[model samples]
Target: MTVLLTGCSQGHSPFIPMLGAYFPYWMLCTFIGLLGAFCLRVLLIYWGIDDKLPVPLLFYFAIMLSISLTISLLYFTY
Candidate 1:
C-alpha cells in the first residue's frame, strides 16, 4: 500500500505507466479494504460493540482512512 501510494505521488513519471497498467489491481485493493473494514465492523457488533457510539466512530474512522489512502495512492500514481 505504501509503495502504491508512493508510485501514485510521482506524477508523470515513467513509473506511473506501470500503475496505469494495473489500475484494476488498485481498484481491487480498494474494494477489499472496504470489505474487510465492513466485516470487522460486523464482527465488532456481533461482540456487542453496537450498543455504543464508539463503534460507529471507529467504523467511520476506518472508512475515512481507507478513502484517504486510496485517494493518496491514486494521486501518487497519476
Candidate 2:
C-alpha cells in the first residue's frame, strides 16, 4: 500500500529541452499566455472597447492566467 501511494507520482517533472538546458513547462506556458493576452488587448483596442473595461489590469491578468492554465491542463496533465 505504501509503495502504491509513493509510486503514484511520475518519475520526471514536466520539462522541455531547450538547447542544453531543461526549461520548466510552466514558463513556456506563461510566455504563450502573455502573447495571448497581448493579442486580446490589441483586439480590444481595435474594437474601441478596451477603455470601457471596469478594471483593465485585472481583466488582462485573468486573460493571461486562463490562457496559461488551459495550456498546462490540456497538454501536461499529471
Candidate 3:
C-alpha cells in the first residue's frame, strides 16, 4: 500500500509564487484561455459567425479547455 502511494509525491508541484502568494499553474493557464475564448467570441460576433454555431456556449468552452491544455503542455510538466 505504501509503495502504491509513493508515486503520488514523485512530481514537483506546479505552484508559482506571486506577490507573497502561491498560485497553481493551472489557474494561470485557465485565465489566459478564458481571455482567448472571450476575444475569439468578440471576433466571431464581429465577423457574423457567432450566430452560426449550433452550440456556441459549448464550442467556446471547448476552445477554452483546448487553449488551457495547450498552454500547460507547452510550458509545464506534470
Candidate 4:
C-alpha cells in the first residue's frame, strides 16, 4: 500500500522576503515576542516586582506566546 500526503495550497507564501533572503513570518514574530518579553522582564526587575509572581517562568512563557500570536495575527491576517 502507498500513501500520499498533500498539504494545503493557499497560493501565498508564508515567508517575508527581506534584502535577498526569505524569512519565516512565524520566526520574525517569535523574535519580536522574545524581545518584548525581555524588555518587560527588565522593567519588572527594575520596579522590584519580578519576585512577586507565583510562577515566573510560566508567566514569561505565556507572555511571549501571547505577544507572538498577536503579532502574527495583526501582520499576517487580511
Candidate 5:
C-alpha cells in the first residue's frame, strides 16, 4: 500500500514530497485502526456479544480492513 501510494505520484511534484514526508503518518493510521479493532473486540467479548472467540474477530478485521481501504483511497484521491 505504501509503495502504491508513493508510486502513484510523480517524482518532482510538491504533493509527492508531502506524501513521502508523511509516510509514517499513514503507518500510524494503519496501526491505530488495527489496534482500535482489537480493543473493540475485547470490549464486545466482555459485554457478552459472543460466547466464543475467533469468529467475532472476522467481523472486527472486516471493519478495520474497510477503514484502512477508505484511508488509502482518500490518500490516493487527495
Candidate 6:
C-alpha cells in the first residue's frame, strides 16, 4: 500500500507580523470571535432575549467557534 501527498509546502507562515513582532493567526481569529460573541450577547441583552437561550454559555461558545473557523477558512484557504 502507498499514500500520496501533494500541494503541501512550508512556504506559508501562520503568524502575522506587526511592530517587528509576530502573532499567531489563531489568536487573532479567537479575538475576532470573542468580539463577535460579545456584540451578539449585548444585542440579545438589549432586546431582553438573552434569557430565552436554552444554553447561553454553550450558545456563545458555538458562536465563537463558528466565527473563528469561518474567518480562518476565508483567510487561510486557497
Pairs clashing within candidate 4 = none
* Residue-level lDDT for 66 in candidate 1: 83
lDDT of model 2 at residue 2? 72
Q: Model 1 TM-score?
A: 0.42
lDDT of 4 by residue, 1-78 (tens): 122322223445687887899897899999999999999999999999999999999999999999999999999864
Estimate the lDDT of model 4: 0.86
Clashes of 2: 0
TM-score against truth, every candidate = 0.42, 0.82, 0.83, 0.83, 0.50, 0.81
Which residue pairs in model 1 clash with each other?
Answer: 8-76, 8-77, 9-76, 9-77
Task: Give the least accurate 10-residue stretch of model 1, judged by summed lDDT.
Answer: 10-19
In model 6, the runs with Cα more than 4 Å from the true position are: 1-10
Each model's C-alpha lDDT? 0.61, 0.91, 0.90, 0.86, 0.65, 0.87
- lDDT of each residue in 6-65, candidate 3, tens digit only: 644636667878789979889999998999999999999999999999999999999999
- Model 6 worst lDDT run, 10 consecutive residues: 1-10
**Better-scoring candidate (lDDT), 2 or 6:** 2
Please give, for residues 1-78, the per-residue lDDT of candidate 1 as tens digits: 677766445344433234447353445556656766777678767998767755687766677568647765776444
Question: TM-score of predicted model 3?
Answer: 0.83
Position 35, candidate 5: lDDT: 78
TM-score of 5: 0.50
Candidates by lDDT, descending order? 2, 3, 6, 4, 5, 1
Model 5: weakest 10-residue lDDT segment is 11-20
By lDDT, the best candidate is 2
lDDT of 5 by residue, 12-47 (tens): 232323444645345655776787788877787799
For all candidates, what are the clash counts?
A: 4, 0, 0, 0, 0, 0
